[model samples]
Structures are given as structure tokens and as C-alpha cells.
Target: MPKISNQNLFDALLDSWDRNNTILVNLLQAFSHGGLEIRAMEGGPSIAELFTHMHYCRLIFVLEDAPECARPINRQEWASEQDPSVLARLLNESAAAVREAVKSRVEAGQDMLVHYDHPILMLQHMIWHEGYHHGQIKLALKLAGRPFSDDEAGLITWDVWMNKT
Candidate 1:
């Protein structure tokens, strides 16, 4: 097997992050189109709850210290009393922070570490976390009898987005 260079790995990480963001944008767009409701599930969170949870995860992996980041928070607490517009603003801010952190890491030539719990790993986790919750949100929508648009799924696979250009 060919060895992958640090730059290549970093590029792949960024691609994953970009694809996640694309899916998030699609989900949010669908949610904004109305018909979506905030409702509790038997053992899962509602769509609103999941959105806030995603924001909290972003803060955890991207902003908090390694030790503090390891601790978990109540998704209900994070989701409660949140104004939709405020949530949107915070989400955008979190996305910007992730982008800046990735850029800084790449510029510093410090992306070659093979074993370390660093910002890069946190960023990578954020991508997967977002994608995972995105799937849950779609399922929640389906359960609520709301339409699940193709937007989010269409953005998950990198090749699909690239082929459009």
C-alpha cells in the first residue's frame, strides 16, 4: 500500500469537513422551509434538540480544552430555550471557527502527528459527529411525517458534489 503524506491526509480531512458542512446547510435549509416540529422521541432527540446538540459538540471538540471536552453535556439543556435565529448564528460561528482552526493547523506544518489528541482530531470528529446527527435528524423528520428532502444526502458523497461542476 502507498503511504499517504501529511498533506494528503489533511486534504482528505478538509474534504470530509466540507462535505459535512454541505449536508448541514442542506438540512438547515429544509428545516427552514417549515412543516418541521420539535417533538420528543422515545429514546432520541427531536430535530431542534439535535441542532443544538450539534452546536454543543462543535464547541466541545473545537473550543474546549482536551480534558473539559471529554465531559458530556445534556442535549436537552443545550436545546431548550434556544431561539432559532440565535441557533443559526451560533452554528455559523462554530463553522467559521472550525475552518480557521484547520487553516492554522495546515499553515503551521504540524499536521503530521500520527498519535495525538489534538485539534486536528477534534476537527475530524466534528465532521463525523455532524454527519451522524444529520442522519438522525432526517429520521426524526420522517417519524414526524415530514418530508425528507434529498438535499442532505446528496451532499454527503464528495463525488456527487464534484460532478456537478
Candidate 2:
């Protein structure tokens, strides 16, 4: 059996992680403040709430497994913030924390066994979870009469995750 080097794997993982984070940032920046209030269903979470929830999930994971790398935030406070800029700032901060936590763990050769047994699984969990919520947020935006063209949506969600061409 060939002994494979994991350096490439780690680098690719980090790239995938960063790509997923950019999806959120791009989606948020694509819309206006009023669009944050849009909801897909009458009682479903608004775009702001969905974003807040995604950040909250990341924050909680980091706080529990990598407190030193976590940037603490009041979930209620962030959810109440209607300003898109503020929300974007908060999202970036949390994303950085998660990135740091993952990077540090990889550098230190550590495993986040408290929950997901390993760093890669945890990272995949975050990426998958955020992707699900991003879909909902986009759906909400579409329901609110603001939406990306199919090409734009393809670019934002699909092409962005692909390797640089």
C-alpha cells in the first residue's frame, strides 16, 4: 500500500472550509438589510435568524471544544441585530474562530472527541449544516421577491466551492 501524505488532505480541507464560509458572506452581501427579514414560511426563521443560527452553532462548537479560539457572542443580541453589516461582521468573526480552532487542532495533532470524534468530521458537520441553512436563506430571499438568477445562484453556491479555475 502506498503511504499517502496528509498535508495535501489538510490543505484541501482548509480550503473547503474557507470556501463554505465565503458562501455565507457572499450570500449575505448580495442582499439588502430589508431582505434579512424575509422568511420562506409564515412562521419560519427569517434570513437574519437563519444566519444567526448558523453562526450560533459554529460558536457553540468552538466554545465547547476550543474555548481559547472562540469569540463569545450573545446569541440573542446577534439575532436581534437587523443591520446586515453587523450581522456580516459577527458572521466573519465566528467563522474566523472556527477556522482558527480547526487550524490549531490540526497543527497540534488533536482530536475534538467531545462530540464529533475527529477534526475532519467536525469540519464536515459545520460545512454541511451551513450549506443546509444557506439554502433556506436563499429560499427566503427568493420568496421575498429578491433572488439570484440561476447563473448567479450556480456561481455563488456551486462554482465558489470548486477549485480556482
- The model with the greatest lDDT is 2
Q: For candidate 2, report its TM-score.
A: 0.87
Give candidate 1 misplaced runs (Cα > 4 Å). 1-12, 40-43, 65-77, 81-85, 109-118, 149-164
In model 2, the clashing pairs are: none
List pairs with backbone clashes in candidate 1: none
- Give one digit per residue, the lDDT tens place, for model 1 in 94-122: 67666666567556645423333555775
Give me the displacement of residue 120 in model 1, in angstroms: 2.8
RMSD of 2: 2.8
* Model 2 CA lDDT for position 103: 88
Q: Mind giving the per-residue lDDT tens digits that candidate 2 earns over 65-90?
A: 87778786685733755787877887
For every candidate, C-alpha RMSD to the true structure in Å: 5.7, 2.8
lDDT by candidate, in order shown: 0.61, 0.79
